[model samples]
Target: MRSFVRAGYNLRKKTGKWELKVRPDKDSMLGRGLLSEKEYHDPVRVFRKAFKEYRPEQFLEFLAEAVHFSLGPFNHAPEGNLIGPYLHLVKMIDAAWLIVERASAEK
Candidate 1:
């Protein structure tokens, strides 16, 4: 299936804690709020709803906030509205794993 939002982990600059960074992929149609029904369902509506109820930054903020930190930059937005590399760390699996685990456990 096609991905809507790309999610990953990042450091909250001020608090110096790791946080999720979710962003719309540059080539994704979801980022533009242009998903076709035939392409997918729930995801289409999910992103559609997100784009309608939340501004792109609000999505970004939700994706980054500690409250929703597990959401991550990897799959930042359900609708694919958020985007970022936040950082350029190539070898991030170790850190990413820890963050994802914590976020999942919190949920």
Candidate 2:
């Protein structure tokens, strides 16, 4: 069994709505205890290890393009269905950027 820590953040929508997100960090206290001291001490290394699970750089570029296209003034989205996907993309890119920043900071 895995343990996790729940975290929430406010995401503002273009329609003036606030989205509440609950993110799982760990499965439980046991999971926390199971992690090594080095894993806990250097978050950037941990992030890099985890980020390897995804195509971070590619995803970052993809999300940035999606956001640009979706939010562009010339785009025709009168109904605003694109907003949700745009926000999600932004969040993913932000996370990737953070990881990159941390990795650079470690140097």
Candidate 3:
């Protein structure tokens, strides 16, 4: 759950009734650096809460959006260190697979 990319990525996605808003500027190097000084909100909590409330199809959509928001910038940005994020990404995918497997077994 903790990774340099997750910690250094500061852009927040705002989901409004029918719209999603993002401010790329907030994810700048300086902005991300400041996060080290304060508490950073982990988006996994948002997804976890949504999973409990959303229907299966709705949860899929929400999950897709979450992955895109979390990984898109990390993938496209230039980075000197990729090992940490790469490992974290693999772990995240494995965790998602486990969730799917457990859910499928219950049905």
Give candidate 1's error at residue 2 in angstroms: 16
Tens digits of per-residue lDDT for model 3, 1-107: 33322322222232222111343344454433222211112333333333344333433344455566677565554323344334334433433343344347658
Q: Candidate 2 residues 28-87, lDDT tens each?
A: 544334334443333333334433443344334545555576775755534334454434
Q: Which of the two candidates, 2 or 3, achieves a greater lDDT against the reference?
A: 2
Q: Rate the local accuracy (lDDT) of all candidates.
A: 0.34, 0.37, 0.36
User: Model 1 scores what on Cα lDDT?
Assistant: 0.34
Better of 1 and 3 by TM-score: 3
Native-to-model Cα distance after best TM-score fit, residue 19 in candidate 3, in Å: 32
- For lDDT, the strongest prediction is 2
lDDT, candidate 3, at 24: 33
| Segments of candidate 3 deviating more than 4 angstroms | 1-78
TM-score of each: 0.24, 0.28, 0.29
Q: What is the lDDT of residue 98 in candidate 2?
A: 40
> What does candidate 2 score on TM?
0.28
Q: If both were scored by TM-score, which would come out higher, candidate 1 or candidate 2? A: 2
